[model samples]
Target: MASAFELTRNMTIGQYIPTDSAVHRFDPRFKLVAFGVLVLAIAFCNTYVGNLFALAFCLALFPLIRIPVGYGVSGIKPAVPFIIIIALLQFFFSGSIAPGGTLHFEYGVIRITGDSIRLVIVSAMRFVEVIFLSSVLTFSTSTTDLTRGMECLLSPLEKVKFPVHAFALVLTIAIRFVPTFAMEMEKLMKAQASRGAEFGSGEWWRIIRRTKDMFPLIIPLFNLALTRAEDLILAMESRGYVPGEERSVYTRYRSKGADWGLLGISLALAAVILWLP
Candidate 1:
């Protein structure tokens, strides 16, 4: 396919879709905390029922947040191949260390067992849930909101002279540039194709050829990323931005009762999920 490098369509991580839903109206700080709690819960959960419940809970947020189910999950398109590889790897290789799963198949260096299969499926489910939940967060929150929320949440560390604002700024910028970089890569791929360079001609499952084809993109992509970062630095400097300087808040966020209620619900949900078998 000629659209191998068309990453923006599959990248929903940094893309924001504005909506007036209650979830969007909630304080970003609360949202971040709740998201973190849910992430930890998802990471700790290993049972099928637990993961399914988590997945369902995350999916339920789509309607609540006014994000189309299809659009919310579009990001999974590009990740499917990698997920398949990981699932295959775990299914084939993990049986060797599994304690007592029923054996399904065996070969000299390959084996399949109930435990291995469960591991693969559970891992994939976790990946999907995390990705979808993340998409929900970024889709609702703007870049400035994310940065401000993170800084506010981490402000306690400033007592230890931690650079909370700087760290938040760096993290936010990194997240916000994901879509930007994807589009830039797409442009570069088109440019190279215009110059008679071959790309995306190999079959998707042909890992070796695909990898080889992508080799030419790494250096130029990195160079362009750096240039973009430099441009950002110059722009910030031009605007008199100073890291670690005391800055006045242009907008102060006060948590509402609904924000607290949502946070409590998140904590409760996490506890319930973690308690699941």
Candidate 2:
């Protein structure tokens, strides 16, 4: 039961799902750059072929990584409805930037909003791609590896008054807790379900009743978050943390030749996506 639910809810976000596929052996740094590039490229596609190509590329990745394409697609089920609504809005939007944002379209008693349609579709598509790509990376690479890679990428920020080490620590904490929080919420849902709490079959006023029903679930989750935060802070301090101080990392960062090669490939794909459209 736990494993199946794990398949459903968390899906190894920020945790590695071990497989014998080529993707598993690739450097996390390479995956990170590839993931980010794929996002920008997918967003830039204005033509159907471009979108199809991007989709195909992403799907092709599943087999290479031995993570079923269906699983990756299914992960986005919760977000599809929002994507559809945004796409529809985008299809009706009106206006161009060059024309001082004049009313671009008018129908009897109705005018389409400027920059609405394309923006929404683009936004929704971009959102979906980014989410899936992140999932792919998480499913392929260990959370620790991803964190180390992020620290290296973000290291440049140290020159501009950013505490890169602290940033990495915070990111690491957030990633670590995603599954914990997911599990807690799942328990809340199931507990309500066991009590025969029907989330559906309610009237307009029933909305309030349903919301009130969530209180038992909400309070516990809030408490859990606070408790976890306190525990995390204590753990950090116990390890001799000093505020605003940099320290040597327990982990070392290294990028090999293979990592660089993959990084180049990721960049090339991104360039093709943007430069084409």
Candidate 2 off by > 4 Å: 1-12, 88-122, 200-216, 239-243, 275-277
How many collisions per candidate?
0, 5
- TM-score for each of the candidates: 0.93, 0.76
Question: How much lDDT does candidate 1 score?
Answer: 0.89
On the 0 to 100 scale, the lDDT of residue 133 in model 2 is 77
lDDT by residue (tens digit), candidate 1, 1-277: 6568678988988888888888888899999999999999999998999999999998888898888788777899778878988998998988654565588999977888888988998999999999988999998899999999999999999999999999999999999998998998899889888998888887788777877877898999999999999999999999999877898888899989999998999999999888888
lDDT of 2: 0.68
Tens-digit lDDT track for model 2 on 167-194?
A: 8768876876776787777776676667
Residue 79, model 1, lDDT:
84
Computed on alpha carbons, the lDDT of every model, listed in order, comes to 0.89, 0.68
Clashes of 1: 0
TM for candidate 2 is 0.76
